[model samples]
Target: MPTTRDYEYLLECANVIGVDYNEAENRVKVFVSQKMPPETLADEDDVKKRVQETDADVTVDVVDAGYDDERAGYEPLSTLEVIPEALEGRGERHRPVPAGVSEINAISTAGTGGPYPARVTADATDEASGAVWSDAVGADDLVRLSNNHVYARSNEADLGEPILQPSPQDGGESDDEVGALVGYVPIDDGVRVDVAARSVDRDRESDRYLELEDEWPTGVRRDGYEELREETVTKTGRTTGVTSATVEATSASVNVDFGEGGTITLRDQLITGYMSEPGDSGSAVFLEDGELVGLLFAGSTEQTICNRIANVEADLGVEILTEEPDDGNGDGGGDREPPVYTTTFERALEVDLEGASLDLESVTFGGRPQPGATVPLRIAVVASEPGSYWVDVDGDRERFEIGGESSDDLGHTVTASAAVPEDAAGTLSVSIAGGRLE
Candidate 1:
């Protein structure tokens, strides 16, 4: 049998994968949270680490969690709706986030009359997120970035239309002119490629984002598609402030709602946590190191979906600006990475002596100890006064004695052990002064 120390190491490595011990063969099994596809299954190394604790020939098993979003079965329909209904909805704007400020949670709007400022987007009802394409777009020319569905209303939008800031539906009066519509791509396969909206006459930060960090964004890395899984990613948006989550699915196909009950099937999309909310679409996704990863688009109750930021840059023809942290000491104190530790999970066991009024309580490996591991039974007998108690097990007839006669109100708690069997069930009979309990 492997020592508990040996078992503990495997337990750490198993973390969320869950642990299963095969006592007969002295093997401990750990399963992956999600089964990576065959070509990518090699990534399992991310979860399975090479940790050897002892020389005792202990077998460790790794199991795949299997690939499945676990969504209820839905018929693959030839979706009929093409253009999405208005995404912008009526919501009052709080304090105005002046242009040129970093970490600005944005809103979208659409209108006429000299490209008025009032919350800008293709729809006037909802507050969708937007980004700046160029820091210097000719005298405060806000070269904002967004999807054609947002800036153009699918194909219903025009080339030279109004783009407001607080969006009129959200009470962006005609006086809040931010920019005008310049370039955009029509929707194709549920996503708009090469999309950009230009907002002029506004001072702004070069390349910053609404981030979770107390400090500002340092630099931005692009398209970390491969290394994103199981790694934490973050985003700041128009609606849900700042949120972070691990990328769960690398390639997913989903049908999403876009208001007025319209739906589209988006493929080759990355899925992360329940971060982004209604108006977070168009918010940027970044890594802990402040590297831009994806464009926040569609999502469900369980996930946030988006395209690689690399694709966003290539299609839109713009570059994201960044400034890496630099502490004067140059010891890299500004960006010092932290260390990590693993946590173990433990469960307790409970049993009671029929008439003996004795309670057995001990926490072990999920309440059932590994075979060959002793289950220290907390034998507690309630009596008016401490006295002799004889305990005998039914299975093996093992006998033990606890306490010579004494005095105590809470009763006596003595120690006992049982060589757990394969089924992990034990029964005992206890005899005290006046009564015998089984």
Candidate 2:
């Protein structure tokens, strides 16, 4: 029964350092690095001893690389034609089947032959990458949407150029013409409205509903702009196929690297768990029940970025044909606006200031604290400047300040104990705030 504190502690220990919380398993997964020779990797016995240090039930998973090596910054190879905007080559992946290798007859995933919503190929200048299809535009304008980089060759493509499904890289040959470039929205501030790749063959019917993540809402419920905050999301792309995540930020401003030393600052964007890989761009993100939410354009090892679907439709002048479009005359049927939010710690969560620091990692009680049962509590802190520290559980607070140079060190981290005051019971609200931001 390890607590979150014990989980953090395991990450700092050797042999069991490369791990992440498995919320489903309720345990930490220890990844044995294979970067070292197999014989040199941490053995089960050694890892178990380290796991015992924190009294955590840890699962050791041996992998070919260490955590640091696994998350290395992605940088695509040189040569401007091949690299895409804001994308990089992946380290290596273990997919069910080699992605882009097996093309099913249907456009469900890694497939070609027809315009399908799940996975399709696109081409320009004799080069290709996977393009996620967006909806249509105008009366009969069946437009499929994708990045200007993937479909338009980074904005250098001519109007009506052939865009292949299951891009040539995945075996789409010159004869595999599915659609021609019809529309493109400009990318500004790392966000773009609508961009199109339309079907050249009117008989080559494509599905209006998404071909992947059928378990989620099977159709677009409504324009999801108002539902952006903390929304649960899922997506299907060519490379990574289908994956799920929670939206971390509805509005964010940040810079994105587009390879070849080109980087641009994007604002008013959505951020989510790093559920995407390199070639997942153009994957359509949706709410369960299948309402379009965002378009997957950029991502990394730790986070993914998307454009709002409403923005996509607006910019492209296209209309998404969801099973349930919002009623134009009213605010739909059922709606409840959550309270406006306040920043809990805006400037406080900064990573490594130029000068001093105070990073509160964890605070945990020995066990479930009972009313009138005071127990030993542990506090884990990483600091550049030492000072008095405080912990709060359900509004009950306590402090532990190390005086003098007694606990001073640059790598200064001390495991200190506090007390869970009597009367602390039930589910508790816990928080810790201290240290100045540089």
Best by lDDT: 2
> Runs in model 2 with CA error above 4 Å?
1-139, 190-194, 208-226, 323-438
What's model 2's overall lDDT?
0.43
Worst 10-residue lDDT window, candidate 2: 88-97
Weakest lDDT window of 10 consecutive positions for candidate 1: 337-346
359 in model 1: Cα distance from truth in Å?
Answer: 78
Q: TM-score for all predictions?
A: 0.43, 0.43
What are the C-alpha RMSDs, in order, of all predicted structures?
28.6, 30.0
Off by over 4 Å in 1: 1-142, 190-195, 202-207, 211-217, 258-263, 323-438
For 1-438, candidate 2 gives per-residue lDDT tens digits of: 443334434333333323334333554443332235445545443544565565545554432222354321221111123422222111111011111211211121222121122212122211121223233422333345665545554445566667554455455544444566655654444444323445433222223222353233345433535356567887765555567898755544334445533544444446677676655666667776666677766654556776676565554544544221123221222221111011112321222222235555334344454555554444444565556554343345555554447665322233333344465554333344444332
